[model samples]
Target chain A: MTSVVAQQIPYDSAAPYRSLSLNTATTKRWTLAEAVDGAARAGLGAIGLWRDRVDEVGATTAAKIVADAGLRVSSLCRGGFLTGREHGPAALDDNRRAIDDAATLRTRELVMVMGGIPDRDLAGARARVEERLALLVPYAAERGVRLALEPLHPMFCADRAVISTLAQALSMAEPHPSETVGVVVDTFHLWWDPTLADQIAQAGAAGRISSYQVCDWLNPMAPDPLLSRGMMGDGVIDFAAIGRWVRDAGYRGDVEVEIFNATVWSSDGHEVIETMKRRYRELVLPSLVG
Target chain B: MTSVVAQQIPYDSAAPYRSLSLNTATTKRWTLAEAVDGAARAGLGAIGLWRDRVDEVGATTAAKIVADAGLRVSSLCRGGFLTGREHGPAALDDNRRAIDDAATLRTRELVMVMGGIPDRDLAGARARVEERLALLVPYAAERGVRLALEPLHPMFCADRAVISTLAQALSMAEPHPSETVGVVVDTFHLWWDPTLADQIAQAGAAGRISSYQVCDWLNPMAPDPLLSRGMMGDGVIDFAAIGRWVRDAGYRGDVEVEIFNATVWSSDGHEVIETMKRRYRELVLPSLVG
Candidate 1:
C-alpha cells in the first residue's frame, strides 16, 4: 500500500476534478495516509475524513499528511450524537473534541449525525439535540468549525438518528450563524424527499450548505440499508437532477463521493478510487459547475 | 372455510371491538368469506377487503357474504396507480372500476396507493396522479366512495408509492370534498414522521382521515420491509403516542389491523386474528376513546 502511495500522481486542483473529494468511508479499508495519497493519485482535490481513521494516526499527524500530500480535508465525517439522556454530558464533551479535531484539520465542516431516540420519546430526543446544539454553537464558531447536521433517511429514525429531513436540519441550524452551523446535502439520504428541490434552494439561499455528498441509494437495500449506498448511477436516484439542485443553490464547495456498500469495500483500494473517479465524472461532474 | 362461517360468533357492534377491522392482507392466505367469518368469529365488526380477494368470489358475492356474516366492509384495499404516463387511460379506468367495487361492497373508503415515478420524473409522476385524481373525483362522489390516498413509507417511493407523507396525502386531498377524497393514516408507513401530531390534527380538522391502519415497523427489517410489518408491541413504534394523536384529532373511525409479514400470514388464520385482537387490546385500543 505504501509503495502504491509513494508512486501516486498528485491531484491538480485547477482541473476538471477540482471539486471532487473522496470521503474515507467510500473505501473503508484504507488507512488515513493511503486515502490521502489515493485521493491525490486519482486527481481528486480533497478527502472527507472519518474520526476513527483520523484517530488512528492522531489528528495532528493526519492533518500534516494531507497537507504534505497537497490535498485538502474537505470535512470531518461526524461530530454530533447529542440525543442521549444519561450520556448527555459525555456526548457533549466528545463533540467538543470533534470540533477541536476539525479545527486542527483545517476543515470548515463537521458533519453531525444527531443520534437516535434513546427511548420512545422521539420528540424529547430531538429537543435535547436542539438544546445541546445551542450550547455548542459558540464553541464551534470560535474554532471556525461549522456543525453540519445530516438528516439520515427515515429508516434509521428509530435507533440511529432522529433528524430525518433537510428541513429539520435547517430548522436546527436556523438560529446560529451559517459559519458556525450548517447542513449537509447527502443525495443518498435525501433524494427521496418530495420537497428536495425547494429545501435545497432554501439551504442554499440561507448559505447553510456546509457540504455536498454523493452516493446512490440501492433498491432491495442490503439487509441493512445503512450499508447499501452504492456508487452514483448504480441505483434509482437521478444524480444529474439532484446535482443540478446543489449547484444551482450557489454552493461552491467540495462535492464528496461517499459510499458504504460491502462490495465496494472488498475491492482493491486503488481500483475503488478509479471507479469513484469514473462515476463522479460520468454521473455527477457534468451537473456541477467548475 | 365455508363450514367455519356458520358456527362463527357474531360480532357485536356495541362492544369494545366495534371499531376494530381486519384488513385481509393481515391474513394473506384467507379467502374473502374466511376473512369475513374470521373477523366475525373474533368479534371484530368489520373487515378491510383487497380487490383480489373480492375478485376471488366476485365483488357482489363477497359483499353478500360479509353482510350475511354480520360484518361491515371498513374499506376496499386499493384504487390508484395513476402515475403511468403511457397507460393513463387504463389506470383511470381501473380506478373507476375499483370505486365501483368499493361502492358495491358498501365500504365508503377505497385506499389509493399512488404509483411510483414512472421514469426519472418524480414531479411529473405526482402531477399525473393529481390530474387523474381530478378526473376520478366526480365518479367516486357519485358512488359515495372516497378515494383515500395512502402515503407508503419513503422506502417504497421508487417502486410502490410516491406519496410518502400524511401531509402530502392531505395536500392532494385538499381540492376535493373530504367525503370524496381523503387519506389513510397507516402506522407502519408514518410512525417516523416528526410533524405527525400536527398533521393528524390537520387531517381531522379537515375531515380528511378516511381510515386508520395499525401495523408495527420492524427494526432489523425483513428482506423486504414492505412485508416486514409486525403485530403491535412487537416493534419499536410508540403506538400509544400515535394512536392518541389520531383519537384526539376527532376521528371516530375503524382501527384496522393490517400486518403483511410472512410469519404472521403463515400462522393459522384464526390464531393470527386472536393474536391481532390481543395485541390491539393491549397496545392500541387503550389509546382510543373509551
Candidate 2:
C-alpha cells in the first residue's frame, strides 16, 4: 500500500507577505456568521463574502461580525450575471443589492461572473452583456463600488459565464473605464490563457484590474465542477509566474485565496482556511515579495 | 418504452451552401481510401486527410483516389506538436512531411495543435510553443503551406495544447503576419471562446484565416476526452451563429466536419458521412449562406 502524507505547508513562517482571504464558498456548508467567525479565528488576513451568505445572515450583521473580528474584506462574492435572457433585469437588480451589500461590508471589490448565453446564442448574449454593463457601470461608480468582472473558465460558458478570457472581459470593460469597472483575474479561469501576461499588462496600463483570485485546475478531471478545484501548488498552473506578472503589471491588490471546493467547505472551516493560508504563503507569496 | 424515431434529416435538401468536408477521424474505423469512397458515396463535397492515413495509403495514390472520387481536399489533419522539450526537432520534421503531403494532395491548409507543458509548467510550455512556431514559420512560408494554429480548449492545457484562446493565438501569429502562418477556427475548440467573433474578424482582417472546422460540444460531460464530441445540432453550441460570424468575417473556407467520437467513428462510414452531410446542409449551411 502506498501512503501519502499530506502535510500542510506553513505560510506565516516563510511568506508573511501572502495574505489569506477565505472565499465564503470555502465554508459553504457553514452559515455566514460561522464562516466569518471561523475565518477570524483561523487568523486569515481577509475574507470574500458571497451574496447568498451575506443575505442569509443580514449583510449589516455579517459586516459587523467581520469588522469586530478585525478581518479585512477583500472582495464581495459576485455582482454580475449579465446574460441576455433569464437573468437580465433580475441580475441587474440583484447586482444593485450586491453593490449595496459590498458598500455596507466595505469590501474593496465586488467580483462579477459575467453569465453565459441566455438562449444558447453566445454572440448575442455577449452583446447584451456589454449593453447591460454600460447601464450598470455608472450606478456602480456612484456607489463607489468597483465592479470586478470575473471571466469564468470556458467550460462554464453554457451555464455559468460567457466572458471566458481576461482579454475579452478587458475589452468589454474598456468603454466604461472607471475605477468601478475593473476586471478580476482569477488564476483558475485565466491560468490557461495564452495572452494572460499581455492582458494583465494591458489591464494594469488601463487601471482596470481589481482582484486576483487563486485556485488550481485539478487534473484527471473531478466529478463536480465547484468542488474539483485543486489547492494552490497542487495543480499545473504557474501561480508564482502569474503572481510575478500581476505585480509587474502594477496590481498592488490582495492575493485573495478564493477556492470553491465543496469538499473543503464540508470539512472543518478552520482546517481549510489554515491550509490555504499556509499554501498561499509558501507557494504564492515568495514570488510577490521577490 | 420510449419510441425514438431517429430524426431523418436529408443531406442534400437541408442547405444550399452547406458543404461537408470529412476529417478522417470521424471514421477511424475505416481506412483513408474507405473514407474517401464513403465520402464520395455520401455526396460530401470535401475531405480532410490525416498524415498517418496518407502514409498508410501513400500520399500520391491517396491524392489520385480522392481526385478520381471527386472529393475536394479541404485541409490536412495537423502538422504541429511544437511544445515538449525533446519533440521539437522531431515535430518540425513531421510537420515538413505533413506540408509535403498536403502539397501532394493539393490541400489548402494544414491544421496545427500546439503541444502543452513538458513538466506541467503551462507558461513555460506556451513560451516554448511560441519559440518553436517562430522557428518553423519561415520553413512553412517557403513551402507555400498555410499552418493553421488550432487553439484547443483550456481543459487540454496540461496535456494537449497550451494555446487556449483565439485572441492568444492571433497575438502569437501577429508578429509573423502572413497567410502562411494563419489560424484554424475550429468550432469545438473555439465555440466557448468569449472573443471568437472578434478574433475571427481580426484573423480575417489580417488575411490570416485559413480553415473553419465544425463539431459540437457534448453536455453532461463525456467519459473520454478525444471521442466525446457531439454531432452538429445535438449539443449546446450555436453553430449556425458561429458559421455566420466566420463567414461575415471574410473566411471563405470549407466548413470541415472534424468529429473525434469513438461511437460515431465505430459506426458504418457511409452512415456517418451521410448524417454529417445532411446536418451540414440543413443546420449549418443556410445560416452562413444568408
Candidate 3:
C-alpha cells in the first residue's frame, strides 16, 4: 500500500486544517480517548465517532474528550437498521437512543445504514425502511440531528443496506427537509456507480449531502467484503474526480477518512492518521479543496 | 438449504421440454461431454457452453457432442476482455475466434463480459468496452452470432466486468443491431438493481435479451466471492419476481442456470441438475413459463 505513497506528491504537506476528520473505525485498536488524542495530535479538524466507542466512555465523557482535544465531531458512525421485521421495535428504539448519543456528542449528522432483507423481499424490506425512516425522522429532527442515509455498495444490498445508490438515498430524503434527512457520499460504496457524477451533482444541488466518508474500494477485495476498504490511493479509486464532484456541489464539510481494512487497523493509529493526511492532500483534496 | 425446498411445491414436476439449460460452470467437475450428457439426460432443452470446456474437447467435437445429444447450445459463456491496452489486439482476436466458435456451435449468442478497469478510470474502461464491442459487431454479424453484453454484478466491476447494469448493456447495444448485439439478463448479477424491472422491459421491448442466466446469491457470501453462488431457493434472490419480469418482457428464451459454487461444483453433477430443474420449476417457471 505504501507504493501508492509516491516519492513525489503534488503537495508535500497539507494545511494545518484541511477540514480533515478521522473516523474511529479506521483506528480499530484505539480507544475513544486515544482516538481523540490521536486526531488532535495529527492536527485534524474533526473526528467521526462510532457509537461503540462512545458507549465505552459514555456519550457525555466522549463529547468532553473530543472537545478537550479541540476537534469537532464530524459525524456519528451509524444509526439505522430499520428493515428488521422482528427487531422492528428494538431497532426503532435503538435508533432513538443513537440520536440521543449523536445529540450528546454534538454531531448533527447521524449516519444511517438501512438494514438488509431478512427474506428475499427486497422491495418489501425497502418499503419498511422508508416507513421506519419516516418514524425516526421526526424524532431525529427533535434532537436536532440529521439521519444521514448511507447508500452502501450494491455488494451489501442483501446483508447491510438495500439502499444502494446516492439517487435512492436522495429520493428517500426528498420527502423530508434536507436538514432532517440527508445522504452520505462514501467513496468506497459509491465510486462504482455509473451515474455517480450526476448523482453527486444532484446530492449537492439538493443540499442533502450530510457526510463525506473517504475510503478506497480494494481491487482484489478482501475476503470479508466488509473489511475490503483500503486507505485512499491504496486502491483504484479516482478520488480526485469524486472529490471535485463533492466540492463543486458547494459542500465545505469535514472529509472523514474511514478505512476498514485489517492492515490499516493493525498499523500504528497515529502513523495511519499522518498517512491519511498525506494521501488525502496528495490525491483527493487537490481537486476537492485546492 | 433443504428448508427452502418445501414438500408441497406448486408443481410436482416440470414439463418434458421446458427450455431449461445447464451452464457447464454449475457442474464444475464435469467435462463438456459430461455436462451435455447430464443436461440431455435431465431433459433440458439446452446447455450453455463454457470456452474452457469447449477448448478441452475442441469446438468441432464439442458442437457435435451437443448436437448428438439433441440439445441446443443456449449461449457461449464469455468473450470480451477488451479493456487491456497491452492485450487489446489479442483480446479482439480472441473475441473474433469466440464468434467463430459460437457460429460453429450453431448458437447466435456469444455472451460478452466487458472487462474490468485495470486502473481507476471507470469511465475510460467503459468507453473502451463500448468501442471494442463496435469492432466485433460486424465479425459476429457475418457469422450470425450476436455479442451478448452480460452486465455483471457491480461487485465485480473492478476485477470482472465493467458493464454492471442491464441499462448500461442496453445503452451499449443501442448503437448496434439487436440481431448482432444483445444484452444478457443474469438474475444473480441484476437482482439488486432498483431499475431491473424497467430495464428488463426495455431490453425485451427492444429484443435485446440474448441470454437469461440464473443463480442464487448466498447471504453470508463464501470466502471466495467468485464461488459464492448458491442453488436457486437456497439464497435470497426472488427468482419468481425476476422470472415474471423477464416473462412479461416477452423473452421466450432458454433459462440457463450458471452457478459457480464450490459446493455445487463438488456435489454430484446429475443431482445438481435435478435440483436446478426442480427449483426452476418451483421458483422461476411458476411465474416465467406458466
lDDT of 2 by residue, B1-290 (tens): 11111111233434442256788888887888888888887766778888888889788899899999987788887877888876467788888888777777877577889876766577667788888888877766666667788888887887788888787788788888566688878888888876577888888788877778888887645666566587897777887778778877876666778888767867888887778877877678877666
- For A195-288, candidate 1 gives per-residue lDDT tens digits of 8999999999999998999998776578767888998878878888898898788887888989999999999888988888888888887777
User: Which candidate, 1 or 3, has the higher TM-score?
Assistant: 3
How close to the true structure is residue B13 of candidate 2, measured as C-alpha lDDT?
Answer: 37
Per-residue CA lDDT of model 3 for A64-175, tens digit only, reads 9988988888899798988877647888999999988888888888999998999999999988988989999888877788889999998899999999989999988999
**Chain B of candidate 1 vs. true chain B, TM:** 0.94
Report the lDDT tens digits of candidate 2 across residue range A1-290.
11111111233434363366778876778887788788777776677888888887787888888889877778888877777665457778888888888778887488888776656577778887888888787777776777888888887787778888888888888888557688988888888876688989999899888777888877755656555587887778787889888878877656677676666666777787778877887778877666
Task: Report every candidate's CA lDDT.
Answer: 0.85, 0.76, 0.86
Q: Sorted by lDDT, highest first, which candidate order results?
A: 3, 1, 2
Could you tell me the TM-score of candidate 3? 0.94
TM-scores, in order shown?
A: 0.92, 0.85, 0.94
Model 2 segments more than 4 A misplaced? A1-18, A84-89, A134-143, A175-177, A223-228, A262-268, B1-19, B55-61, B120-123, B134-144, B170-179, B219-228, B248-250, B262-268
TM-score of 1: 0.92
lDDT winner between 1 and 2, please give it.
1
Query: Could you list the iRMS of every candidate?
Result: 1.6, 1.9, 0.9
